[model samples]
Target chain A: MKKVLLSTLLVSLLAACAGQDVKDQPQAAVEDRAAAQTQAGADAKPTGQQSVTANPLKDPSNILSKRSVYYDLDKSDVKAEYKPMVEAHSKYLTSHKDAKVAVQGNTDERGSHEYNIALGNRRADSVKNMMNVYGVPNSQIETVSFGEEKPRATCHDESCWKENRRSDIVYQGE
Target chain B: MIFRKLLVGAAWLLLAPLAHAALTIEIVGSGANQIPISVVPFAGENALPQGITAVIAADLQRSGLFKIVDPAGVRPEPHELAEVNYPDWRTRGADALAVGSALPRSDGKLEVRFRLLDAVKQAQLDAYSYVIDRAQTRATAHKIADLIYEKLTGDVGVFSTRIAYIVKSRSHYELQVADADGYGAQTVLASKEPIISPSWSPNGAKLAYVSFERKKPIIYVQSLVSSQRQVLAQFKGNNSAPAWSPDGKQLAIVLTKDGSSQIYLINADGSGVKRLSYSSGIDTEPSFSPDGAAIIFTSDRGGSPQIYRMSVSGSGAQRLTFEGNYNVSPRFSPDGKSFTFIQRVSGSSFHVALQDLASGQMQVLTDTRMDEAPSFAPNGKMLLYATEIGGRGVLAAVSSDGRVKQRLSTQAGDVREPEWGPLLKN
Candidate 1:
């Protein structure tokens, strides 16, 4: 449980600049994983499966680890930079026939809630469409828009709003 | 073990009633032409559960239409029409006087007699008397206030109506139905998840709202009286934005089951679902017109979100709003000549705006930023909406002409998605 949460946090922190080679990228990445591990309060259990059979979805080096794609204000389109990441997930879905995913679309805390709901629905559908483009079967994907209900960040300014306009892909039973 | 269990059960029952009636109201922006009136303390009304004159006065004052002149030193509270001393009220600068009395009847019921008098003309304007049960005190007071408001303002009164809103605290979300005055709130549904888009049935008996209790939006219709609820829509994907048609037999709901958040019409019993909109882009927030012949909804088919009108027969839709790139939540007035919607003035500042259908004139009703869920009072005299004040979500009502304003909020939690229920029929 601790490793999974730490990996999720690490992936979210790297969503914006995952492939970049910044001077402090590896150091900050290690620090965030360490902090999240301490908060989870559990250490590695020396499982031999972590070496050759680690879940690719949780491996920080893999693009599949990044689940969220942030959008512009009131926008539902997956940006050009995020397309490679979304296509990677779509390829994963196509390969894993039994894996089902729900794309949860979210929005910033602005505009009418009902309109935002529709906007978020479009966002989720956009991801589903991208998956369909990669030959992912319709039965493997579903969409739900949380609108502005579940925010990644709570502050009312643009800093938080920018982080909140997002769509997250979740595999079932994970 | 049974004794301890019974004590905990009793404690929960004791605290249940305390959780209700938390919504309080504050009136601001007085009417430019407020009528001066004095509502005297009703004789024997102090013995009842609710203050008759106080409720009446509050209802009138909250509208920003009437001022309650203090009757502190009026000698001998008037109980009958003959004893109302109009000249004394005229000297107190009151143009009208409301007097009443409540007494126990022979069969242990209560009898309430009320009268409205014109101070300048020195004549009784309206009189009403009712034999009611103790449970009907507050409603009867609101009815009397409604009668007084109608007699003076020449418009129907909505004081006897109810409003439904979602209250979000840290622990859970509660859908509450309260009096129009924000009193006597009763929770209709509570869940650990979100509840939104509360739509009142045309007859005012049921509320059709979307709840995210099962990790997805599903439409449900719950009886305000019996508390019995059933799912109206639970399709393959998200089913949300339930709206009642004027006839009450069918509902217009938005569904993503077919993809792209299209609008659909379904029986109120959750059967006979038929697709109503087929736009390529997102189309949602469906609101029915007063005559049920048309539906006004938000659609992005024309490249941006705007209000559009379509025939209920699933015909082609015509866009209705052209002023803003973002216009949604279109609610028709009771008379159907105009609609109230949320218009994004610019980046992030959304205001409640009204548009007349005949002439393309639009009127913005509020200066408050972040306004949503605008529902007209049954009479179309006021628009009740959800807005953020000091970063706390609260319910607010703006007069149709944007002259008067008031706020209703709970001591704890954020309130949003307010839908004012209709003036119920007996």
Candidate 2:
């Protein structure tokens, strides 16, 4: 009897998966095609020599790879320590006209939810202002504040709060 | 779906005293003068179908204006004022005494009568009677209590009012409503996603809140009686912070669809969409003044979060607070003379503060380390807000004069965003 019940459960689970494939299969195929086209483009570049066109955002050693900049409590000013990281991303955005980025501002969970929304937006705007001063076009950058809704840490302490208060730089289609 | 099951499992208790005590209210402060009163058990209670005297006593005790002297053993049951037992209650330090009786009718109804007496003068103060069924017994008790409270305190009692709040545990979030004294809690809506910002309609029939069920913040107006809800705002971007206008004809919401967060007004039926405020920085948390003349909100236009006021037509933009570097969540008092907001001092902690609109003078009310969402009671006598106690979120009430403080906490998890409902006509 136990074996019969187990088999029945396994068959039902497989049937559920088959039903899901009807809705998700086409999207998965489209994603696979896009991945294959990107691979083909990379292969078309000459081999045996270093490729001239390389996205710095994907380069491990480039400062543009650093995506997040931390801020102090209730403060939106970009800290001195994260200046180099912000500058590098600003330089990349100004040079690459097609590049578009979204600066998402966040805050620690210590205040009202809606107030944190405003504070988070200020932090994101601070980053966008710095990038604009560095010659990044206004159309290439967008700012949004998630407030304290999306916290990086769950611990209720200063160290965790420091990690949660940050602005993340996200590149388009990365 | 979870709420439907929980509602069935709630074991609706109409007459019996609450069995499951989810939140315990700890009175930390009290007024100086409390009128001492003794409420004797009602006679012929077999037909009452509910604890009439006990509910009345609990309602009076919750006001913090009356001290209850137990008459369980010290006094005898007297059905009328002519019984002449005022000497015994006076000796027990009770300035006033209440006696009542419930008689059964042949039509399966109850005739409840009560009399209030002045123990000092040995004279009758008031007497009333009502014919109600079993289902209306609890409401009758609350009504009797409100009458007694008004006769003594010269102010209407909020015993019959309702309170709405959000309760979150693990991944389950439920919007629960209870009596003003935090008893007889009933779930309004439950979901695995988060729920916040519960604003009651002026008529106390519906609620406006933010639900994240669709993986994005959406504003919903839900009816209190039935579980029916309507999507008031579901624009492309974030739609949050829904505040109902006093007339119940409009709602002020914060929407991010127009590039940045800004305040917008929509009809109660979700028809008209009109932008209200214009600012480069984030403009959100819009609260209407009591008279519906202007709106007070938080904006970062001046470098940091500060409270700003704008007319109903979005013209007379002016700053309201300059004492603190961080201020947000401004809610006007019921009389429109003052407002309350959360003010943070130099990154130390957040406190609830009240500012007079005319004088511009501010006074801090709470000493909690992290306080948010201060809402005024409908009577304008007390304020209800959310605070953290020992790393757990709890709801608390403090008098407007800053004299009385009480903590309302559940057994586990967090309870936040308490909005006191309006007084309904009985």
Per-prediction DockQ, in order? 0.32, 0.22
- Score chain A of each prediction against the true chain A by TM-score and list the results: 0.70, 0.69
Candidate 1 all-Cα RMSD: 10.9
State each model's CA lDDT, in order. 0.80, 0.76
lDDT string, candidate 2, A31-136, tens digits: 2433433343333232324347865555433445456778888788887656656666776676667889878788999888877766777688889889988788
Tens-place lDDT digits, model 1, residues B1-426: 111221211111111122222212122333776788999999899888778899999999988888889988888767677787877888888888888788887887888787777777776776667777777788788877887777777677888889999999974789999999899999998776678999999989999999876667889999987888888999977888999999999999988887789999999999999999988888898888899999999988999889999999879799889997889899999999999999999888999999999997999999999899999998898899999999999999999889888887754789999999987654
Give the per-residue lDDT digits (tens) of candidate 2, residues B147-244. 67766665666777789998888657789998887877899887665678888988889999987665446889999878677889998557888899
Q: What is the TM-score of each candidate against the true structure?
A: 0.86, 0.78
- Candidate 2 displacement at residue B138 in angstroms: 3.4
Cα miss at B39, model 1 (Å)? 0.6
Query: Candidate 1, which segments miss by more than 4 Å at Cα?
Result: A1-52, B1-30
At residue A147, candidate 1 shows an lDDT of 89
